[model samples]
Target: MLDKTSPSLPRGMRYENQLAMIEGMSLADIAREYPTPFYCYSQSAIEQKMQACLKAFEPTGAKVHFAVKANSNINLLRLMAKAGLGADIVSGGELTRACTAGIAPADVIFSGVAKTDNELEYAMHKGVGQYNVESIEELHRINTIAQRLGVVIDAVLRVNPEVDAGTHQHITTAKKGSKFGIAYSQLDSALQTAATLSSINVRGLAMHIGSQITSLEPYSQSIQRMLHWLEQLQAKGFAIDRIDLGGGLGVDYGNGEYLEYSDYAELIQASFANYQVDIQLELGRSLIAEAGILVSSVVSTKQSSPNNFVLLDAGMNDLLRPSLYQAHHPLLAASLSTSARPETFDVVGPICESTDCFHKNYPMLRPNTGDLMFFTVVGAYCSVLSSSYNSRTLIPELLVNGENVRVIRKAWTIDEQLKLEE
Candidate 1:
């Protein structure tokens, strides 16, 4: 049973009978305008989620950086920038996008384990705010680049707290044996090394345990560890003025409950009060995941022995989370009569791979060919991970505000793909 009260359900979204409506516009009407196999994002819903996150972290004066990898749609980036949000980017292209989208360079934090020399040079030239250095080699690279550029580069040493975030193994970052951050045993040496570099300014430290994290325990533990490190660094006469608690806040994905913003804020405020340093949060999925969904139409239906299947035009190439992480997204009919019967279906996509399925034996109002379905909680990683595999045209993305709908990205044509080769 779907819980209507779940925080994962964005504002202005409701069910008029069996038809899903966003801000009073029926999904069928949206499909008629935009066609099937497209992504529709609710502008008001995105704003609501962003406001909730800001409100939760308000007491601490922490700046929230919308993680760019989640969904770096230029339009969405502009919306977030307009809301006074910063950007947490992992690549040079993302940095360009963030700046072009109106996020000031000072508001951008570059994070990733393997930042190349060219990327680091580009970031320094752009006057990027801070570099979350993952390894000693990277630290040296920053120092060398800054020396050549004749400017001091601000940076933070990313530490591995070894806290088991208890989330998906693929997303876990800080646990022992993970190749993400500076090892705890080598932090002192790294700080010593940083102090010796004339072009490097060790502003503070950063850490990201994992993504899709639903519990606050790991976050609290990681924060405590960071604070302890801050104290030690301060005692050692290192002027640490900032602490970036990396983002991994999770949203309910129909698999489990999420830690409410109030509770999460309380936990963060309690641990962060001991220090006077500026705080930064790198939030990705939680702020945007529930704000959008994939709307696809049923191409056909079939039965294989004891199981039934419903095929859609959207495939793993459209949204890779299910094929990559075995993730779950609640499926619902876009429109149905009150007399529609409920049946279990293995909803799948048009991809050729065997892992192209979205839902397996999930009960829903039985849909016929040409009927529409909504894959919930796909705002973050869906379109961002889409591809042109199997020679399929890239899907379009639409933004809805109140009853008005507009296209953010148009469907790429086969000719557009061919033009690249031409």
Candidate 2:
């Protein structure tokens, strides 16, 4: 039946009358309204995920912060704000976006390895809730900035537990030499250094192992290590009132199993049952990835020896995950014929580089020129990482709420791109 949903499709998506639909709106219909290579998100899907995450972590009294680095569209941020999620930003611009989207500064947690002075000053002026201090030098810098601003800034020491998250190496942050948090062995020294900083109040600890972590072992190990230190620090007379267990919850991107929110929350509650501190989680891809899809049109088809290439209008400049991290996203045809035979095709983009390919030897229903396609599970790191490479114009983004759709971001035209140049 046309109303039946497919198990292969992500949440908020289904195949209706052989056409892929998002929140009841067909991809083909939306493609006609907006140009191809645009991103479309389901407002309900995101809200539902947020609700599930909140429910899962509610037992631990965890404050969920949406990682601003993932899908930072103002409308999406506003939706996150409306859902009672705080912003975990890595830069000043994201802080501005969060605030502009109606998130209060007091709810923002500023986190990044190399926060510039200007960004720190701006965050301080805006009264960000906390800063995740990465290094002792950064701690001193924050102290100097706080002293200059005549304010005592609340901060958390991000400790590197040296746990392997088993995610992509490029995304892992907590390994021994990963240049993320301070090494676990150096925690005492970092705490000592923080003790000397008159203007910085080290109220808690933080650790972000990596992104897209599916296994529970890594989180278990890391949290155990952090809790051990938390106990030691308290024994040493430090008042740690919070624990920022940075987000690395993974989402299924055509890969196998991912960590369930309930399992994750149960782990957190079990680990911290005896502690009386505020727990914070900064979730990014987990909450948004499944809610979004990138729509593109097949530009042309090429036949080469042992390979059928489906060239698409969407390039790596639009969605870099495949090229950048060899990431895999489910590629589907917007409309498929009932009797269509599956074909193996190397899906590629029109970019000049050879790395512009999306998938190789991917089996899907045969696509023709002008056929609409979708790169599913791209809500998190896709559009935010897009660049105007090869002079390609930036694509637009649309938010779908049932039958209602609105353009959240307008396409960046060549004229607008040229205005920044001399």
Candidate 3:
């Protein structure tokens, strides 16, 4: 029997008759219909999480935008749109995807550090609601694009407050010397320049400290700094009306520790109660990470001197967080009926690179060849980061709504990939 009390498992995932089940369907059944090494998302889980997030931030009158970089699948984006969430996009393709997903262009906020001139013009043409300007150069570029289009554009200056997010360094974005946002010291001059731009309306300030942030202290510190600048800009006669608190809220990935949305909402209310400006949020992982899992079939198991290895069909190309960020995802066997004893395994993928290992020295029930296994809390970055490296075909993704399942993305075949080549 699966341990129902274990926090590592995704919500709504449990065991029935010693078989792993998602929602009301058995994983073995799903794997039989759809191939293994595919991603499966629970519709009910995502909807519940979204509703909770919306409720938590409702008191702040915040406009929540789902960061499209997390999981750009159009089906999921459509679900977010249906839930009344806007799109926080960073590329023209993402903007198109959001629009195609039925999110209004007025609800899109284009955010990135290196948007090209063509991208700026395209966003303007598509009527993107706001632009989070990373540098004075980008601000000038927006002004130029707006001038060429003969339309005024709404924009906000993204400031780096030099606050430590206390998360992984690779995901930390807003500290000093980071290439993400404008330097705090240069905000004054940036605003002065924006004041001279006739086609651009710099309405507010934006700041994103980092991703997977567990502590509220960093957010508190970053908000304090942003408010300081907001007050300074207002004092200087700038009509500052918005504060984009770019999202870095973390979710629990088997650690049983994460930032609560209620606490974050309380902090926002307490901090901005005196101010009358609009609040905007760009949330990504926290909303969807715990709603999906990657189900893979065990290919083989072997002992190599000091380490026991269990190989699966999925690789770093399919889920790169382990190799790229050293992220940990709880692995569980589909069936707990194995006669072999539980063992410590270095779960690995069939990739050519040495960095394709998922977990090291992990304790789990011994899985036999052809048995099903899954990695939890992978809904956000797993599918979006997949690559067709080493001639491996991209896997399919399925969304489950109770007993009904739908393939949201079709698997890429080797023939299709070869067709693109000579």
lDDT of 2 at 220: 99
Q: Model 2 over residues 1-422: C-alpha lDDT tens digits?
A: 01124756788888878888899799988988898989999998899999989999998899999999998999999999999999999999999999999999999999999999999999999999999999999999999999999999999999899999999988998888889988878889998999998999999999999999999999999999988999999999999999999998998877656889999999999999999889999999999999989999999999998899999999999999999999998888888776878889999999999999999999887788999989888999999999889888899999999999999999998889999895
Better model by lDDT: candidate 1 vs candidate 2: 2
Candidate 1 ranges with C-alpha deviation above 4 Å: 1-9
Q: Which stretches of candidate 2 lie over 4 Å from their true place?
A: 1-5
Alpha-carbon local distance difference test for all models: 0.88, 0.92, 0.91
* True-structure lDDT of candidate 1: 0.88
lDDT assessment of candidate 2? 0.92
**127-176 in candidate 1: lDDT tens per residue?**
99999999888888899999999989899999999999989888999999
Ten-residue stretch with the least lDDT total in model 1: 1-10
Alpha-carbon RMSD, candidate 3: 1.7
- The alpha-carbon RMSD values of the candidates against the true structure, listed in the order shown, are 1.8, 1.9, 1.7
Give the Å shift of residue 292 in candidate 2: 0.5
What's model 3's TM-score? 0.98
